[model samples]
Target: MGGWFRENILDAGKLPTLLALASFVLTFLITRTVTRLIRAGRGPFRNITPGGMHIHHVVPGVVLMVVGGFGAVGSGRYGVAASVCAVVFGIGAGLVLDEFALIVHIHDVYWSEEGRQSVEVVILATALASLVLSGFSPLGVDTLSPDEREDRVTVVATLVVNFLLVLITLAKGKLRMALIGVLVPFVAVFGAVRLARPGSLWARRFYRGRHRARARAALRSYRHDRRWDRPRRRLQDLIGGAPDRAD
Candidate 1:
């Protein structure tokens, strides 16, 4: 009996599982409360407000990174896997910038809007980076040998926990926007990269062609209704000794 228990549970060990559990619980509870608060304001908890939607959207992504990092270190994926997780996390931080921009645009709704948004995004991002680093590292399991199957408990738990974290963001209405917000920077940056390369020149040219066409249409309308024309017509009438300017 002892040997069977050791083979199943202790074979892969307990530290990784424990750490993942702790992270999952902490992030889940914290994010849920935050979402509830954002959806329902501070007064009597009865009032609904857009109090915390912005930061709540970002919390899950951060949780993933944290759990990934912890899995890397505890599972023994410390070499190249941890490094790759770090790089991806750096990219994720770049993604968070757009979210920050949105927060800036809607500052009137939040009290210390920028500060709160930044803190939440940064914390969640760090957690997610850690999880990725730990889970897929050499110690982790993104790559497995032909005959190998990882400890199913750890792998399954991680997937389930991350899914729940995401659901919290959606429990309110911001998940779709959060995903799009994260991807927007990636689209712009990758498109710019393609634009600079000669191989994708045709695609870039097509984009520019469309942009120029739109600009031309806008300019035509601007010239057709120039603001100066209105004032000039009034001045000309006054100089020509017509009726009063008011008329």
Candidate 2:
């Protein structure tokens, strides 16, 4: 275990990143627990309200993000200082993402169904970080040989090709695929070659007046949702707690 950490983490100069990832996940989990407790009114935990105005966690998160971000910028990427900065940044990210739905909706809805968006965003963020930690470099740069990397034209070409593929995947309305594809180009290729979602820009531009294609795309989307929606919701509920029932 130590050997693996030395080789994969230390040698790769990813100790700070690893530390940050750990802190990020732990912070999110802890924050969720406290918030849930407060919501249930089953523990001593309670919301932070001053002068009858609720103060959300995102406030401190932004502060940490600023401090850690600037600290990281000044300290480079190594040593104890960098590690500390990474942890701080990770905590900030966790707090901010935990309230992502509030940010997007511009209102407080932490216990409502809309709040599940925060869970989804955090899951996506975690998955992206995990992929990076697992040795997937942006735009598949890690896939290139040393020789290819030395050749500027080859490196530029590879990056451009991968970027276009990711863009196409995004345009096709496969947001998750496009995001993952930024790390794994093959995933982007899969998304790029697939049919666009019914209301996606790609579909609207290309599938216009094509009734059959629209029907097929809609049907595929519906089937895909049917297959994954329940499992996805269950996983979200398990991790972030279920939404509150409306009176």
Candidate 3:
């Protein structure tokens, strides 16, 4: 185990990344728990306000991110300083992304339905970080032989092809597939060849006059949402608390 850690994590220069990802996940989870408790009036936590202005956690998050990011860049990626900067950056990222919805809407909607976007973004970030920790390299180059990796032409070609495939997958409205495809090219390829989502750019452009294809896409989307929406919502609510009911 120690040998594997050294070879795959430390030697590969992934220790800092792993540390940051772990810290991000931990900080986000802790933040969510505390916020939920505060919302329920069951904890000592209270909102921060100064000079009649409500101060959101994202303020400190941005500060920490800037300091840690510059520190990491300046100090290099080995030893204690790098590790500390990575952790700080991770904590800042967690805090910022936890309120992604608020940032997007520029409002205090922490408990509203729109706030669920924050949960979704956090989940996506966690999944991506986990993939990285699991040794999946972005752009799917990790599977190449050392010799192929060393060849500039081969590497560039592979990256370009994979990038186009990812773009196609995104156009098809398969965001999750596209994201995973960055680490696993085959997934992106599959999404590229599949039917586009009914409302996706790909469908609007290519399947516009194709009634049958549009019908199939719509039906598939409806069935998929029916099958997964509730379960997905339940999972999000379990992790981040339920959205506040409309008054």
Candidate 4:
């Protein structure tokens, strides 16, 4: 079984590997661009001709592009392992960007309760429209460079997938959604590293450490909440004519 798997899977990683690499490059570039723009004191989409833009909209599209590309390119490289990694990365991407995802969902959550959904709705709509356009074609830019078309397509696909993922979470909130939020980016990189270096036990150890950090963060939050409760109760008692120490 090991021999057959090795012969078939390990040897068939070239295309998927390339796709995964492409995803990594695209994601890194997009993330960096957004970060740089934010740091430059320039609001996102400032240079657009007329319609304006939300720079944050790039993340989801990048995530989805990677997911689709990796899945298609590496479907056979590691059997079920590849599929699992893809799902993990896809869900993780969805979860990590749950904030942006929530921007759209807030409308659903407070459809009648709030009035400021207009701005969020507008930004999100623009992003979704951009995704649709880019996913189907490059749209406006000159066609001098093939790489430009590929980049545009990847960005659009990523946005669509991530946006769809947000829709799914809004429709179905559960443990599965939470898990995906935490795992997509992690699993994509994890799977890629693992594929690139099957013998690296250190990678596995590093993931374990990450889990431990999450556990610690939860504990800290719980403690902080408990501390707040005691103080609130004391303040309420004092307000009701009971003596309470200032310290």
Candidate 5:
């Protein structure tokens, strides 16, 4: 185990990233737990409010992100100092992402239905990090032959093609698949080839004036939601507390 750790993580210079991913996940879980307790009035935890103005954790998180990001950049040496900076960045990211919905809406919607966006982003970030940890290189670079990698044009073309696929996947509204596709382009290709979700930008543009295509896309999306939405929401709720009903 130690040998694998040293060879794959330490020697490969991925120690800082590993530390960051660990810190990010741990900090998010801890933050959620604390917030849940506060919500339930079951612990000593309470929201931070000063002078009748609530100070969100994201404020400090932004500060830490700036400090850690610069520290990592300037350190230039991936040793103990670099690892510390990585942890700081991870903690800051967790805090900031926890309030992503509020940032987007410019209002406190932490417990509202819109709050699910935060959970979704965090999950996507975690999954993307995990894919990297698992040795998946972005843009299908790892799949190329050594000769192909040595060719500048081949590398650039591969990246461009994969990026286009990711963009199409995103347009189709398969955000999770689009994110994963950065690490594994095959997933993006699949999403791009599939029918777009109803009301997605792709469907809005391409399916316009094509009633059959629009109906098919809508039906497929409805079926998909029926099959997956509940369990997906349950999983999200399992990690982050369920969002409250709309007011």
Candidate 6:
């Protein structure tokens, strides 16, 4: 375990990234717990307001992100200062993304169904960070041998193929799969070959005259959603607290 850490983490210069991700997850979890307590009227935690304006946590999050981002860039990659800055930035990111839906909608919907977007974004971010930490390079370049990496034609071909796969995946309306597929090419390949979502660009373009394909795709999507949605929501609620009844 120690050897693996040294080789995969320290030697790979991923310590700062690991620290940042850890801090981000911890800060988000803690923040959610406190806010949930406040919502339930079971804790000393309270909302912050000033001058008749309810101040959201995103405000401080943005400040910390800026400061830490600049500080880390100035301090360079490997050192105590950089690690500290990374942690600060992570905390800021957590706070900011916690209210991502509110930022998008420009309204207070922290406990609404739309607010679930924040949870989804956070999960996506965490997954991406974890993949990076695990040594998965974006665009699957890390899979190349040293000679293949040095070969311009090989590199270009690999990049072009990966890019097309990513585009196809996106057109299929598999946003998360497309993002992750940049790091793990096989994921993108699977998405690219799969049936597109009912309302996706790929479906509109290719399934226009194929009623059976479209019907199958829609049915599959419905079944998948039915199988996963409830469990996913329960997990989200367990972590971030349930949405308010008013929503």
**Tens-place lDDT digits, model 1, residues 1-247:** 9986556434544334434444543543454354345445543333233675434334445554565655466545234454445434333333333245345665432222233343344345444445443443322234444334566777655444444433333332333322322223332223332222121333344445576554554564467458655774454233221222232
C-alpha lDDT score of every prediction, in listed order: 0.41, 0.92, 0.91, 0.40, 0.91, 0.92
Residue 215: error of model 4 in Å?
A: 19
Instruction: Compose the digit string of candidate 2's lDDT tens values, residues 114-214.
Output: 99999998998899999999899999989999999999999899899999999999999999899999999999999999989989999999999999999
Q: What are the runs in model 2 whose C-alpha is more than 4 Å off?
A: none
TM-scores for all candidates: the values are 0.24, 0.96, 0.94, 0.26, 0.97, 0.95
The TM-score measured for candidate 2 stands at 0.96
By lDDT, rank the candidates, best first. Answer: 6, 2, 3, 5, 1, 4
Which residue window of length 10 is worst by lDDT in model 4? 191-200
Root-mean-square deviation of every model: 19.6, 1.2, 1.4, 21.1, 1.2, 1.5
- Distance from true location, Cα of 237 in model 3, Å: 0.5
**Candidate 5 runs further than 4 Å off:** none
Task: Estimate, for each residue in 1-247, the C-alpha lDDT of model 6 and write its tens digit.
Answer: 9999988877777888999999999999999998888888897898888788899999999999999899888987788998999999999999999999999999988999989989888999999999998888889999999999899999999999999999999999999899999989999999999999999999999999999999999999999899999999998888787897871
lDDT of 3: 0.91
Query: Per-residue alpha-carbon lDDT of model 4 for 1-247, expressed as tens digits?
Result: 9876545435644333433433433443354354345545566534323356443433455566477557656666556666555444434343233233235554332112231232233233334333332322222133226675579676566545544443333333222232332224332223332211111243233434576654554565467568875775454233222222335
Q: How much lDDT does candidate 4 score? A: 0.40
Better of 1 and 3 by TM-score: 3
Clashes of each: 26, 0, 0, 9, 0, 0
Q: Please provide, for model 5 over 1-247, each residue's C-alpha lDDT reduced to its tens digit, 9 standing for 90 to 100.
A: 9999989998888888888889988989999999999899998999998998889988998998888889888775468899999899999999999999999999998988888889989998998998898799989899989999899999999999999999999999998899899999989999999999988999999999999999999899899999999998998899999988756
> In candidate 4, which residue ranges exceed 4 Å CA deviation?
1-9, 12-22, 25-30, 42-49, 53-56, 59-221, 224-247
Error of 2 at 188 (Å): 0.5
